[model samples]
Target: MTAGHLAVIGLGPGDEELLAPLARRMLDDATDLFGYGPYLARVRGAPGAVRHPSDNREELARARAALALAQSGRRVAVVSGGDPGVFAMASAVFEAIEAGPPAWRALPVEIVPGISAVLAAAARLGAPLGGDFCVLSLSDNLKPWPVVTRRLRLAAEAGLVIALYNPVSRARSWQLGAAFELLRQVLPPDTPVALATAAYRQDESLRLHRLRDADPGGADMRTLVIIGSAATRIIDRPDGGSWLYTRRDVPD
Candidate 1:
């Protein structure tokens, strides 16, 4: 059978309104789909799509299934909540394709970008990433702890506004605490930080706090942390929502 194409659709955070028209159209046209179960559930109304749901540990399996379906000439959409390219399923899909049968290699692949957690968090808290920023994932599942720690420290030392994905999980409870300690060594206690939970979802909560006051105890895999650079400032807006801004200083 001739291999079918792969459409990597980023379904956005969770709001139906955030999904791009093209992404919705692709999902509507897919005969088979692959993604984490929760993400698939969000788009329950998508037509004629067979979902292959998998847990975090089954990423390789999920990718392989998607690839296999595509190779069989079935239009497949690998769904991801938020943008797949930003610390999501895109890498896993590429890795699976690289490791799959030769026939799968020639299949066309398209990545449709969506609103990443970093962007959603930044939007909720004004423009904390107006200057330069770096994104770091605290999950050490795929990478070594030392490497994650090193990048966190380096990004902090460089004074880049940092957006943290996968901040903490039940199994990785101490990683965020260690990251806080490392940031404290380089940043002031009063540095601004924003915690966006379940962004763009019905239960969304946005909390703007100081670095010293940030408590990772309430954080989970769904939380996105925005740590301000030295130049980032928090201003009280007359409209009730606070604005976090990172000022860019140009050389004379």
Candidate 2:
């Protein structure tokens, strides 16, 4: 018997409208859905055999479980927030496939992309990513902190707009502070910064600040932090807020 199909999808930030049509279609067609509790909660009326909700830290375990279901000829869908390919379950699934039995490779797998947090945040904040940009996850759960630090420094030095994901969590409250300190070392004090929290959600809030004054204490897992490059600019909005963007042109 042929192996079942597996589809990995992203639900986008926190809004249903941001979800890609392809991802919604896959979710509807899936016989089994596996994801973190919060992300799985975003899916309504899936009509699947069951929704396997697990902790956020169990990516590999979740991926393997989903694959096993697919191997048993069940249409399985693994869901994540934002683009699954971006620091999400797609990598975990691929890693499992590469190390699992060769038969696992034969199963048909599709990646259904969705609006990443960076894009959603950039849109809400008026295009801070208009120029070259780099996306980094500050969580050192999978990688060493030094690696993240080095990448952050280099991205800043290269004048790339830096979009930071998972900036802070309860267990690691100091990471965002440390990250901001690092950025301050290379970037000017007045560089534009944007904090997009829960973009598009009901409680969504976007704030603009200068690098010197940006505080990390308020950021959480739901916040996406943007550190602008030299060319980034911010203009006051009519409503007393501000819009930020990076100038597309750069001199030689």
Candidate 3:
């Protein structure tokens, strides 16, 4: 008997238009879908796929369950909001394959790429990530707080444009404040910061703030907080709104 196959797909940042054609095709072929609830609801036209929606931070269990379905001759698709590889289901699926039941290793697995939230945020913010950038998750659920804080400090010191994901949630609210505090130690108080909430969804709001003046109240689980590098700057637009961008060239 032929074993089932698993496809990990990225649905993009809350917009149907942003989903890739290949990902849509895979969803069409899948018999089962597994993902966070909100992300699973985005698969509008997949007629026969059975969806298994779980709460946040349950990635490993979800990956294992999806793989088991695949091993049992059902084509399974694991969906994530952004690129699955970016703090999403792709790594969880791989981690399952590595340490799961040995039979799981034999199943065919594929990952379909999608536009990440950071990229979507960058486009909305006038390309603040034009130079070297780093994406970090502020949630310390999987790692220690010291480690997260250390990386925040090091990334700021290195002057890399930083895109912070999962900045604030119900159980963990103070991390964003602490992150801003650490960044302020190495970065100027007036450094440009863009908080892109709900990137492509309805109620989307993108606001520019100085590092010192950044308001944690502007962020939620759906937000992508982008802290600009030292070289990043804002330009007042002739039309109306301001543009935040990092120049490609560096001073001699």
Candidate 4:
């Protein structure tokens, strides 16, 4: 009997064109698909794939269900909006595997990579993260508030450009503000900050501001915030808008 397999696939940001070809083929060949409702909706119609859509917060349940389907002699694909390994379903899937039945460990599990939001956001913003950087999720749902703040402080002190995910949501609106305040203590007020919302999507929005002037109100769950390091600088384009980038220090 052939053993079943599980594929944790990244669906890219929002644009379907950004979705990797390997991911598309995996979805086409999957017997069962699992992901948040909106992400699963992107797959027009896989011939024989059964999609199991769930709420955004129910990751563990989704992972477990996908694993179970794979164990039952089915080709399973667990989809995530951004790169699965980047604060997405990949970690949850592995966590479930570690805690699941011993037989589950022997199952063939593969992770197909996809373009992450940070990379897309940075590309749209003139490479603000071309230098050393760190990515942080501002959502305190899985971790403590203090832990997030501490990391922000340390990243800022280390002079690393920071990319923030899940910056704001309906229930959690003030955390982004607190994060900015914490960075203000370590970074200069004039530090460049880039806000990219729904990047590459129809409703995409991009904005640039100094650290002190950044408005947290503009942020949302779909937004990815990039804060420039001390070495970062903005170049004014001859047309109008500015291009922000971090200076790469090398031999003269």
Candidate 1 on 1-252: residue-level lDDT in tens? 655989888988878888888898888888888888878877753566777878867877888888888887989998888899998889988899888888777888899999988898788778889888999888889999999989988898887999999998767899888888888888999999888899878888888888887887767788999999888999997998788888887234
Residue-level lDDT for 58 in candidate 4? 97
TM-scores for every predicted model: 0.95, 0.97, 0.97, 0.96
- Pairs that clash in candidate 4: none
Writing each residue's lDDT as its tens digit, candidate 2 over 65-184 gives: 999999999999999889999989999999999999898999999999889989999999887888999999999998999999999999998999999999987689999889888888
Candidate 4: 10-residue stretch with minimal lDDT: 243-252
* 1 or 4, greater by lDDT: 4
* Over 4 Å off, model 3: none
The reply for model 2, stretches above 4 Å from the true place, is none
TM-score, cand. 3: 0.97
RMSD of each: 1.6, 1.1, 1.1, 1.5
Stretches > 4 Å off in candidate 1: 1-3, 250-252
C-alpha root-mean-square deviation, candidate 4: 1.5
Candidate 4, residues 1-252: lDDT per residue as tens digits? Answer: 668999999988867789888988988889898999988888654777788999988999999999988999999999998799999999999999999999889999999999999998888888788789999999999999999999999998888999999999878999999998888889999999989998898899999999988999898889999999978889999999888888886223
